[model samples]
Structure formats: structure tokens, C-alpha cells
Target chain A: MQPQTAPSPQFSLRPPMEAREKFNRLTTWVIVAALLIWSWRGSEMNPMTLFRDAGNIGTLLGDFFPPNFMDWRLYVKEMLVTLQVAIWGTVLAVICAVPLGILSAENMVPWYINQPVRRLMDAARAINEMVFAMLFVVAVGLGPFAGVLALWVHTTGTLAKLFSEAVEAIEVSPVEGVRSTGASYVEEVVYGVLPQVFPLWISYSLYRFEANVRSATVVGMVGAGGIGMVLWELIRSFDFQRTCAVMAIIVLVVTLFDLISQKLRKMVI
Target chain B: MIHVTNLNKSFSGVKALSDINLHIERGEMVALIGSSGSGKSTLMRHICGLTAGDRESGQIMVNGCLIQEQGRINRDIRELRTHIGVIFQQFNLVGRLSVARNVCLGALSRTPFLKGLFGNFAKEDLELTCKALERVGIADKAWQRTSTLSGGQQQRAAIARALVQRAEVMLADEPIASLDPESARVVMSTLQELNRTDGITVVVTLHQVDYAIQYCPRTVALKKGHIVYDGPTANLTRAMLKTLYGSESDDLFGRKEEAPTIVQGAAA
Candidate 1:
């Protein structure tokens, strides 16, 4: 390294490192403090409420204890129905979403085609699954089919977005290598594009399937059919014991599906 | 079997190639030599119809079919590409695919459309793919994932893919630029073997002048979008290089005669 020159009479040759470090630290702290203050005000929160409301939480926890197992078979049957809803919904979503996923990717289509398809997916995702379940329940009347439709629409939007990202991130030369062989557009997608994205596509689908199972249980509360119907009814009648029982069943089933999906993903990936 | 007349290209209103004219007979191994940003790649892209030359000043013909004229690619260029192969310096294979499967992709154009989609290749395609792999000396690697292969092995697989395509003309854009000297020698020998034995026309771009003189008898040199030299490679002597590249000639041809010739490497 060059030896440091004598300090210039007018100004120093190099910056003051200590002052720069202090300034950077101050700026970071200021930003974090601003964010904390803004969120506290926006939520209308009081820090003292944590201590004041401690007893209310304890009372709720007390009511949740000593869970009842009466009609365990009925709860299991309803849990199976919720699982069925997720399965049928994911099946339909996979069918619809894979094609839309390819179409939505700008690398696969011209912007003219990709733009409208992406907008449609964005619109589908704008509304929450609960709201979609309510609308479908109104349309189809109260049933598991309504829950299926809700999960199908929501998962289709999410999975297609992920699939498009995976497709876009593939190496370009492999596609060009296929094109050099005089491949048509469809052939390019099958041979060049699909192989690169297949593992990621499978991973995304499995993840979506897991998420849909959890969502399926909640949609039943909106009159879309599942164990949430029983849970909601018990809560309304102040049958906290039965509500706890259904909640436990939901947790067990969701965990089971998560484990299955994880295993399948591991085997394939 | 390729002819280019008055080819010109510009990117964002800046000229990349101008007023280029050339012709290559069948089964000629010609080298396009140049410094960086000297229009070698641009010329190769234009020949393959991957990029269009300047409007109203260009025409290219390969195997008697018009690839492009007046900077517009012919609709039939898609069909024409079935007879021409192109290779790049990097990312030449789909890493997730098997070597055999990547070779199989080269036959997709001629296969029935549905067969290509469903991957139900004909018996002829399989036989040809095997033959191609064997020719490239990588038949043992047919079942391996492409990413597992070394750089030389992957490039050989790419060459096998081209052989499966049955391309009459091969345009390689700096195929050995990213390779070591030994691997570069192997690739050059493969191209040389294909040119000599199968009579496939090979046009390759090179930054190393010694490789060009050692492998290709004909040389075309470009400097800043202009054809500075086009003649026999034997005539590209120190005096000629000095005139074409001036002080930078040393950088282009600086490497000594340590690398073996294509024939010497092929025999090994």
C-alpha cells in the first residue's frame, strides 16, 4: 500500500472512518425507531395492555383445558371430509394452474398474451380464500364443493405465480440449444424448458397442497362444508370442550398432511 | 454451401458489422478470427438466422435456401435450421437431462409433433442418437445426467446432438473460448474429424490466431466491424498481423507454439 501522504493543509486526503461508522449506526437506529413508533401508533396499541389483559388470556386458556372426546368418531369423519375437500381442490387446481402457469410466463409467451393472464391470476389472489368460500357457498349452496372451488381458485393463483418464476429463471442456452435443432415452440417447452423446472414445479405443487389442506378446514366456517362447521357450532353454543376436540383433530390432520407432503417432496426432489 | 452478400448489422444505431461479403464451399473448415467486439459473433448469428442484419443491405443463403434478405428472416428459415447446427461457448446442455435425452432433442424437428411432445421417439432416432454418442466417444456417458460431465464431455455431447440433427453446416461461436488448452484441442480435433470424415462444413470463430492457423486453412479477420483480412491462413504471417492488428497483434497471437495441432491431438 502507498504510504499515507502528509495531511493536506486545506483538507484531509482520506475520510474520517470513525465518524462515518458513527453516522451509519445512527441512521440505522433512527430508521428502526421510526418503524417501531409508526407501527405502535398505526395499531392504536398501548404497551401496558399486555400486563392488564394477562388475566383474560389465562381465563381463555383455563376454558380450553380438560378437552372432551365425546363423539370422536364424528369429529374424525368431519376431518376426513376436510381432507377430501383439499384433495379435490388441489386436483382441480393442478389441472387448471399448470397450463396457466406456462401461459403467464413472459419467457413462454409474448407480453400481449402474458399480460392478461398475469392480471387474471392477480385478480384471483386479491380476495382471501374465506371470501371466495362465502361467494361459492352462495352460488353452489352449502357443501364441500364450495370449499373445493375456493381452494382451487386461491391455489391456482399462487402455484401459477411460482411456476412462472421457476420457468423464467432457467438457463437460456439450453433453450437455444433446442432451438438450434429447428424445434417448434411446443417442442422447446417440453424438451428445453420443462426438464429445468420439473423439480421446482413438483416442489411448488406439494407446498400448495399442504397450504390448501389448512385453508380447507377454515373455509368450512363460511358454510363451505368441513369440520369447521362443527367447531363453529360448538363455539356458538359455548361447548368449548367439543370445540377443543375438533381443533385437536384439525391440528392432527394438518400435521399428517404436512408430513406426507414433505416426504413426497423429498423422494421426488 | 453458404453465401453472404453485403451483410451489415447495427445495434441501437451503432454498427457492429458493415458491408460483409463471403462464401464457403461444401465441407470447408474456415476460421473467423478477430479481437473482441470485432463482429465475428454477429456474423455467426446472422448466418444462423438468430439475428437480422441491417435492412436493405444484407442477404444470406445456406444450402441454397434464403435464410434472410433485406434484414428479414425468411419464414422457411425454421425448416432451413433443420439442416444447420449452432453451438455456443457456455451453457450448451440442459444440466438436468440425461446425455442421451439431450442428444435426442436434436431430432425433435423431424419427429411427428405429438411424438416429440410425448417423447415417443422412433427407432431410427434412437439408433442415430447412439451412433452420434459413439462418434463423440461418449457413448458410455449416455445414461448420466448432463451436469455430471466435465466441460469437454458436455461440449462433445453438444456435438453429438448436432450430429443427431444431421446438420450439413455447423457454425460454432467461440466453442473453445471458455475451455483449457487440452480441452480446446479435443474440441478442435472433433470438429476437424467431422469435417474430414463426414464432409460437414465447419465455420468457427476464434480469438487465438494460432488455433486458427493450426486447424483452419482459410481465415477471415475482422477489426471494428470491417473485414481487415480474408485469405489463406498460411499467409497470416507476422507482417500481415502487424498491419491488421498493429500493437495488439502480440496479444492476439501471443501464445507460443506449445499447443498441439488438431491432427497431432486427434491421433493421441
Candidate 2:
């Protein structure tokens, strides 16, 4: 240019944010900070108490040292039972979740059907697994079967929610391509939707299995069955040494499963 | 044969297509040409009963079977649609499935529900799938996951799927819109070859008039939802297109000079 000119108006490196957007963003941060502060007080959080009670915790921890392994055989046996309960529970939940998940997916069914099915799933999820274990113990008269039933219902609710979300996020064009072939609805689902969601479904199911294994050990606290009942009895009688031994077993088993399932999930996904 | 009458469509109060009537005989390759927002794809979707027209709109019939009327698709549309194959701008193949399985899915209508559900096709259906894949020139790709294929290859796979359906009429809605020039030519020629040899009724919507002039014997031009021209491709002159599309006609010619050479080369 003959004269030094200002930069052209046509190009902008970045568009300036509107005042309203800036205001909204600031408001959002303020609300989040306010909520966090309010919850901190409401929940009675006191970080100073940790240092104040260090001696009491040390004495309590000392009681758990040199864990007693006298009932190692019983502990191992019950741990196997816990694994079995988790296996059956996860298997049944996966089966039930398949149909329930499809029924609850907004893209798969109408609002009337999905709404009611979602509400039912919500009710199932709203109750804790421990609560369900107590109810099932009463109904089934206490055993591994009661633990299995509790995990099945609770896991079905969780897996169905996960499965439906995967279904909803799928691209609709593939399903339309299937529909154009004059494939029936069930055939379209089996061929189109199922293929797209299969990997994610398997991944979610394996993840739920990991969670269920952790839960299975605790269901026995309500007399549902397995190592948790033994754990509960030891804790109640202040048998801290044996309690430590049982806790160690539970931790080992859960960690091993988590690792195996993570590898499997990675392969599938 | 496909027949559409009084096909009116409106999206929320704005007219997309209005008062249209068309009849396409079997074994004819017709090109539907229009600029974007000209309702060509919308009209094609209506023909196959993929979309419902206005409640006051008239009937659409495919092969003398009622497809849709007064905004309601026929109760037996699933059976009726078996003979109508539709190709989209996006290939729309299931990415995780093998190409062979995707083609076999075309026979799902004839297979038993439970068998199809379990992905167990009949022996004849499998043979048909193989033959269809071979015909489309991608039989080697049959074992590959569909998502691994290139754009042109995936489109060919979609055509193979349609072939396995034994479709009597193929409706391609902007089938080549998203393709490169080479892929576009390949897909158009494949469609042309099918029309000539199989005697299948073909209706393809195209944006570039060069392709229409080269591939289709007859042309139907739509502007603002009205069929401004319906005649032999030889008769649609530049002036006629200019009058119909006004300043936007340049888009139809596909940037002027290139269109003439392609059309002239096809004519020669």
C-alpha cells in the first residue's frame, strides 16, 4: 500500500466475547463457588479434627496389626462363593438389561413406553443394593441366591441406563439404511443398532461386573451370604485382627478382577 | 413404475414442495436436477414412503401398490418397500459389520425373523450376496469391516446391498454429492449400467447438470418446488435453465465452461 494502513476489518483472529456471555460465565462460577462453600459447612467438614484425633486413630490402627489367619480356609471358601454370586448376578442383569435398555432408549421406542420404563429403572436404582439385599434376604430366607437376586436387580438398573445412553448416541443413518431394506423392526435392531452399540455394551457390562464384585462382598452384611457375613460377624465382635485378614482377602480379589476386566474392556473397545 | 400425485409438503408453514404430479415408467433412467433447498431429495423421500406428505396431499404409488396417501404410509409398507432400494448421500453402512454381512442384510425381509436376528442367512441368500458384491466390483472387500473402506468403496458396498435386495426400483438421493469427481463418474456409470442391463427404474437427484446430461436420457428440473421442465435432456437449453433459476443457474451449470465440454463430449 502507498500509505501504511490499518489491518482489514474482514478478518478476526478470534471473535470477541459478548458482554452477556461474559456475565453469564461469571455468574456460573459464582454459583458453583457458593454451592461448594455452603456444602462444606452443611456437611460439617473439619480438616483440623484429623490432627486432633491422630492418637486415637493410631491406637485403633494398632489393634489391626498382625492379622490372624487361623480361618484362612473358611475365608477362601466364602470368597469363592462371593465370586459365584457376582458371576450369576452380572450374567442375569446383562440379559435383562438388553431388553430393558432397548425399551428405554428414546430413539428405539416412543416416549410413552420409554418414560414408564425409565421410571421403573429409576425406582430400581434409587434403592441401595444393601436395601435390596435386606429385602431379598427376607423373601428368599437368606443365602447366596438372595445376594444374586439383589445384585441382579440393582445392576440391571445401572446397566440399562448405561446401555440406553449408548443407544441414544448412535448415528441414525445406519438404522435408516437397514429400514430401507424393508427389514422388520427387530431385524433392524439386531443388524443395525446392535452392531453399532455392541462394543460399548460389552465395555459397560464388564465395568458393571467390576462394580458388582465389590458390592457382592458387602451384601452379606445384611445376611444375604458370602464373605461379607463373615466380615460383619468379625467386626461386630471386635475381632479386629481377623477383620483385617478378611479385608485383605476382599481387596486382593477385587483388585485382581478389576485388572482382568480392564484388559478385556480395552480389547473389546 | 412410480407415480406421485398432488404431493404437497410443508415444514412448519413454509412450503417445501407443492402441488406436484409425476409419473415414471419402469426401465427409464431419470435425473432430478435442482439447486440446494429445491425439494429434490424431499420428493424422492416421499416416493419411497420414508416421509409423509401433508395431510391434504394425494397418493404415491410404487409398482401399483399404495405406498402413502393423505399423510399415512400403507400398513404393509414394510413389504412394499422391499422392492424399493434407496441410497443416501452418506453411505450409511454399519461400520462394525463386514461388507459381506451388510450385503446379506438385504435378504433379511425374506429370511425368517429368528434366523436373521441370529445373522444366519440362507445358502441362496449368501450366494446372492457374493454375486452382488462381485457385480459391484468389490468382492475382494467383502471380508473387510465397512468403516475401513474409502468413500467410493463404501458407496459401492451400498449398491451391492441394494443389488442383493433384488430391488426393482433404485432411488438415489444425491448419491454422488459428497464424492470426488472420479468416484462420482464411477457411481453414475454403475447406476447407468444397471438401468440398461437390469431394466430397473432409476431416479437419481443430481446437483451438477453435467452428470444429468451425460447419464440420464430424461431430465426433470425443479425450482422452488415446481417442475419447471420435464422433457428430453436434449431439449433443456441454457436459456431455459437461465429463465427458471435466474442468477442461481450458474450453480446448475456447475461453473459454466466445464459443463459445456463434458456435455459436448458425452454428445459426441
lDDT against the true structure, per candidate, is 0.89, 0.93
Candidate 2 chain A least-lDDT 10 residues: A1-10
DockQ of 2: 0.72
lDDT of 2 by residue, A108-149 (tens): 999999999999999888898999999999999888999999
**Model 2 reaches what TM-score against the true structure?**
0.93
User: What TM-score, to 2 decimal places, does chain A of model 2 have?
Assistant: 0.91
Writing each residue's lDDT as its tens digit, candidate 2 over B216-253 gives 99999999898888989988888888888998888987
Docking class of 1: medium
The residue pairs found clashing in candidate 1 are none
Model 1 chain B: weakest 10-residue lDDT segment is B259-268
Model 2 misplaced stretches (Cα beyond 4 Å): A1-42, A46-48, B255-268
